[model samples]
Target: MATIGIVDTTFARFDMGSVALDEINKNASARTVRITVPGIKDLPVASKKLLEEQGCDIVIALGMPGSAEKDKMCANQASQGLIQAQLMTNKHIIEVFVHEDEAANEKELAQLMENRAREHAVNVVKLLYKPKKLIKEAGTGQRQGFEDVGPLGM
Candidate 1:
């Protein structure tokens, strides 16, 4: 089973981070991917600890627009913190930008955020498992078959 640590910078509004997590968790293949949602403070440390303790294979960091500015600063700070955690723990990190600003096109922003998160997850899985050879070598002892079949038996 794979575990994932979820860090949401925007705890108040319906941020893209949680939505992306929901999408990931909804997949049957993600059934064993346990997710933990921790508070913003000490997020880097907490996420690293969760990865170590829970044996999480990946860490997902979610960012949202802040009350001030375009929330870019907050995102940058959060991303930096997550990067530090990744460097220290050597854990795979997926930084997702969630849009919650009403000034922008909310629907378009949401779609873009969701797409980015999905792509990040795919990339993380590929990097961790080396899927290209695995796909070709599956059932040949070179690669382990899917432990938990994804939806549609991906």
Candidate 2:
């Protein structure tokens, strides 16, 4: 069985992580290990490192950065660290992030985060157990973004 890791932060909505776990379990028979940190500042080195050291194959990292510039800086730093961790471990570290101000309202932001988490959870299962599904879904709106612009035109 494949072992998946979840590295999350308290700054994000807890339900988002819970939903991700449910999605993962519903899709595939796998073991999931979760590590929750105080905030995104600790997600990269602390939680992810611990999970990787404990033998998780791929890690799904979730964090919610604030709209402020400083928060974005910190998020970027953590992301860079995660990149290094991925290189060192030779495992995929899926980054799932939602900013507070991305949506006009709180409810919309929550929904967006939940949607992103669940979608990524499915992706985790597909990547680990059934890559063909992932291939079929590719270029088919699996990304967690505002909208699909399709191909650019002159």
Candidate 1 local lDDT, 1-154, one digit each (tens): 5565555543534454555566566542542233435434445665687678767777766555454664556656666887888898887776665535533675655565666566555545554556594476455432111233333432
- By lDDT, the best candidate is 2
Best TM-score goes to which candidate? 2
Q: What local distance difference test score does each model get?
A: 0.57, 0.80
Task: State the displacement of the C-alpha of residue 122, model 1, in Å, after optimal TM-score superposition.
Answer: 1.7
Itemize residue pairs with steric clashes in candidate 1.
29-150
Across residues 25-111, which tens digit of lDDT does each residue of candidate 2 receive? 899898888888888878777645755577788888899999999999988998898888888777788888888878898888888
Q: How many backbone clashes does candidate 2 have?
A: 0
Task: Please report, as a residue range, the 10-residue window in candidate 2 with the lowest summed lDDT.
Answer: 145-154
Q: Candidate 2, TM-score vs. the true structure? A: 0.88
